[model samples]
Target: MAIDITLIHWIYISFILAVIGFMLFRRDTTIVCVVGILTLAATSTLSVSASITSLFNSFIFAITELLPTILVISIIVAMSKILTKSGINEVMVAPFSKIIKTPTTAFWTIGLLMMVISFFFWPSPAVALIGAVLLPVALRAGLPALGIAVAMNLFGHGIALSGDYIIQAAPKITADAAGIPVLDVVNASIPLVITMGLVTTITAYIILMRDLKKNKTYTSTSTCSSSPIEETQEGLMSERMKKILAISIPIIFVLDVVVMFTLNLQGGDATALIGGTALLILVVTTCFAHKKRGLEETTGYLIEGFQFGFKVFGPVIPIAAFFYLGDAGFYSIVGDYLPENSEGIVNDLGVALANGVPLTKEVGVITLTGVGVITGLDGSGFSGISLAGSIAQLFSTAIGASTATLTALGQVTAIWVGGGTLVPWALIPAAAICGVDPFELARKNLLPVSIGLVITTIVAMFLV
Candidate 1:
């Protein structure tokens, strides 16, 4: 069960630390990540020319692994776009708006509704779906735009994305790296996700209510985005048509969820089912909305969706490429350079260190939470989670801990911090959609998010 530590292992560890260092300062990690890959390749093949070849090969591997996730997100975004253009998005949330009569109701109603929509649409598009229609209704209820932004950011990105029960995008990446079942990660995440979601959203609501009572309206006027989503044009489709599609789309997605449960589809299979359904909805909705120009409009929507997907994932791919070297990817990228006794560099290190160091459960929990928060500093919220899963595997193997619990803890912390609640730049989508300052929204979320993370980390410690 014991294996020797090699030079390649040291290289992987050092570069991981370097990547974390870069992220902590809010700097990009792409260059550090690539350099790490090239170094690993160079050491493995012992040939500069071969090392260079392996660098590109690593990216190809990453893209191939990530393409399905990108496609599903792109297709869903395209579907949301068509819904917005046809004014169906408005129709979807209209029923909920009737129940919102006060600031407290506005906050909870929007936050909870955002959590649900985000489960289906992902948060970026969910922000678009909820904010445009529900924001005005929330604002009219006496909540400031900043409060509205916080609700959407926390509930959508913080809660929904951390769990990712529908898309399974976040869990898929993490579980794959941990070498465990995707449902293992998903099932383990349920409690941690609930704790984080309830703690953060409730704390945020109480504090926001206090602030709103002190100041009835916001004073800041600074905006980051050149355009806000509140400026979307009037409905393109007829009112009857918009209403029909609005009813039909949610039913289709609901049925997809039912199918997912019935078939026991958790990872890529579930995602494909949703993606294919979204594509059909997008095509059908575009035809009705654009009439004579439906064909051209559908292409344009697909192009925009793909652009959005790539732009969001551009920073992710390089970091993912670097982390993949920790396990199976090392053999693929670095060739046959690992020691004969090694299971994988990380697993080998775990066994060696476990014998020598004996990491306790408390230490394991804290380290994972720290790694999650630090990796999230790059602001993508997702770019470094492969590292989290790999680290979880190491610590779990070392300390005889629960890999699923540790992975879930890291996943929750990462999303709550960088999934738009604590990071200013990451807050842009929610901020722009709600017409508030991103930094202001981040500031508002700081205390509640920090408190929630601490509680969740402690809870994870006990779980492990």
Candidate 2:
């Protein structure tokens, strides 16, 4: 059957094209989302009166859903700010500096710390913490600021945030679309993630090596100007603050890890656990910051936290709203759709391709991987995983490829692109925190990431 594109399809395609056009010409996430939403409304025949309303409603809904998580992240960030002001953040990483003497070790240490913290806390918060503390160490150890940016970008945001095994954001999207268990998707994502990490990290190491050699031959060093490091004044509970933070942060986080293992709360539950712990830490930190005015201070910190959250996620809201429209669950929010249609443009596309394209298991896996990488060009890794999961569904048939392999490949490619490597915009947090150029970071990651992606694809062919 010839694929019949409907009004919904046209709306979606127009939105995507508008985003693409904006990216090419504008490169602003906010503008791209606004243009995309407007185009979608126009294509859907929404009334002028309803267009803005729909957009606002959609935006509000998306934000509300994400607000709790963002709030938790904000609290953590606020606590990190408090920690920074107290000079404890610097103190925390002081030990690591002594242990990691060389530039290479410093780079990897920061990268590894980023990866670990990001896996539990997330990339944004991890970036702030690591950048505030460890970045100086790396730079002082002779690592280029750009190099630190790349390491954090790849290991933390790109790999850890993209996979999000502990957080479950990525898996939840994929699992819901595929109608499979989240744990299954998590399991499937592991080998592909490991392979991609090895490929990308090794390639990144080689690039770092070359850069190091170049630095060796040059006496002129482009020293990064010192980033403003804020130190909070000691509150009434200064002594207690020191003890609590030193003991509390690690203890709670460690408990979270232990709980995750004991209960097998692998995905969303794990994220919730970590977020919950961060909230507790936030309250404790604020209490220390204010003492008698703890309540007021906590509120103040919460507001600051929300402001930071909004700053980081405000641009993402509309973008996610536009992408949310592509999902069946939110298609109605975008506009009324034709009857008999399920949600998401990518899912529809996947179904059409699955039914029409005749292929073997290997080809099916490769095709799914390509679909993931293509959809990921939008630079929101989670946006495309639904399509990946839909593709995974096709390959899960009796005669199809292994669903696990298909899912893993889809995750690896989607994340690699949207998480950091290909898109300059996606590297904003790490790049900004490191005080480096986002475009340069993206460019540096390209070759290493591409080689890793290819190697991962080949590895998936055999393993999956």
Candidate 3:
């Protein structure tokens, strides 16, 4: 049966292409999304007033749906700030510095520790924590600053943030868009994440080793002697308090994880546990560090946390609103205001594709991968994931592929690209900390990340 493609479907497709074009040109997508909302509304409703109202509602709905994730990421980032102020973040990774006696050990140790810390605290904070305490050690162990940057970028942002297993923020966003359970995305991502992580990190390590051999300037005696650990002022906390909080924080998070597994908490339940614990830790640590000013300090920290959270989400909300309209649930929110029996533009398009398009699994995987990569070019990594999820949901139904596997593939690719490994601007934190150019760091990351992405994509074929 041939499915009829409506005007709305073509409009949606056009907007998608416009978004990609905007991203490619390195332009802001917020305006494009805003325009898309207007166009979608105008096409779906005859009344101009109704179209405007529907547009506003879509933004509101997207915010309501994604608020929890924003909150979780904000609280976790705030907690990291508290830890940094208390010097606990530095203390947390201090022990690992002792294990870095050689270049090989330094690379693996720094990379693995970065991966672990990034999982819990996020790469933004983890970069500061690892860089302040461990970078010097890795440098002293004969790794170049560029090499250290690669390790942090690949492991922290590329692998940890891409998978985002511990925090579940990335999976939550993708899962919500796909209209599937978050655990489905989380579970499906495991194998693909591992494959990408190993391939990229190992490839990077080999490249670094070959470069080191070529340039004797990176020898242990020469490189180790020059780099010294940079010091920063610790906030108003006693040494004992710092030690206590450092120990307590990790233990608390680990226990949260164990409890999650014990109680079989998967999606929002798991996220709530983590977010709530972070809030508690933030309070406790603030009180201990600023006893006289605890009340005022806590408020300040909360404000700062919320500020950072909203700042990150500011660009994301409008983009997400445009994509959310593609989902059936969100569409209903706006659809009710439209003409009778108006359907989701994207979902309707999906139905058409499923019936009319000649989509095999191979074609489905490649097209989705390309879409994910293009969406990621916006450099937010996150902005594109919801689109990927929506597209994955559409294509999976069209071709009889595993929705979870497809969604996971899209999630991984979008994140790895925009999450920092492939994008120069996104590579700033890791690059800056190591005193290397962001573009140079991105260049080093290109081969390893490219190889890893290809292998992971191939693995995704089987999963799909």
Candidate 4:
């Protein structure tokens, strides 16, 4: 009845702690992750050459496993580039812009639009997508740049990314580690995300309103002396064509969703459908926008997108590879070295804890939330959540709790903390776009986000 905990298990856990410590200290974990893999490999194979080969193989495996996520992100970025260049983004947001008459309207309008766009294009690009065009208008309408930054950060990077329902990247990673279906995590996260989003955004808006009432002279940050908007350049596409693409593009993506539901597609199949749609959009948009040199321009846009994708994902891969060793990567990257009757290293640990300790759902909920916040200190939100997922699986099994709820809790906490709201560095894109100091944005977000996390964690206890 006892599960055997192997040396590999200890190594995996030890390296995980080291990775967390590094993240807490705000150090890069790539080296720590690589060394962890090599140590696991060397322990398993006991041969220097094979161990090194295993290390290389582990990287290959990580890349292979993450390729679909990478591909979809790259393709989406490619599509966004074409959309931005062709001025179609302006067309897309025109109707929404007309409704922003005051600071209240500005906050809700920009925040909601950012959340929607972020679901599809992701927050980093979505910040650029809506920020530049709307920043000056919001500033003129009396919303401070800091308020704008907070809205985008909380709505787009915090709310949209935490749920990640459309793209499913966050859910996919956490679900993989929790050893559950992606839909399970997504389904469980809906309520928690809504709660966190509502609590955080409303709290921030109220605090911001009070701050404004007290300091009616409160104005945009110093950097807002000039607009972030670029001068409009004449493009290859006509205004009529831009407007057409703007209307048609959303319809195409909407149809992708309809088709997904109709065909019962999910997971990788769903992601593939979305990726294919983005790729087609990129090609067609580039072709229409570039006209004669459409072929070359399309390639050029894709290359840029790939570059951005890899740059963003590069730090994530090594860390992800290390966590993969806890479960699926154990046999392939190391060896069939798990003890007999052992489910996996992480699972074994969970079993051992369950047998030895009196764990409860409350303990599990708090632990996952704590781990999520600690891991999020690194500011690269995605880099640390693999650890969250692994830990969620470990804790949930021990507590006899729902892995999906625990995993979703961890996923949301990590993203809210590091995905651009609480972390200064992660908040830079939105901050810079709105001409506010990143630290100020993070400061403004601290209270609201902390409160949200507390409430969300309490809600998660019941869910678990």
Clashing pairs in 2: 85-231, 85-232, 326-344, 328-343, 328-344
User: Number of clashing pairs, model 1?
Assistant: 0
Please list the C-alpha lDDT of all candidates, in the order they appear: 0.76, 0.68, 0.73, 0.75
lDDT of 2 by residue, 385-411 (tens): 877887787677744567766876787
Q: Lowest lDDT 10-mer window, candidate 4?
A: 220-229
Candidate 4 scores a C-alpha RMSD against the true structure in Å of 7.7
Clash count of each predicted structure = 0, 5, 0, 0
Tens digit per residue, CA lDDT, model 3, 294-320: 889888878876766565456556766
Ranked by lDDT from best down, the candidates are: 1, 4, 3, 2
Candidate 3 residue 403 C-alpha distance from true site, Å: 13
Return the lDDT, model 2, position 409.
Answer: 77
Quote each prediction's TM-score: 0.66, 0.72, 0.62, 0.64
Spell out the clash pairs found in candidate 4.
none
Best by TM-score: 2
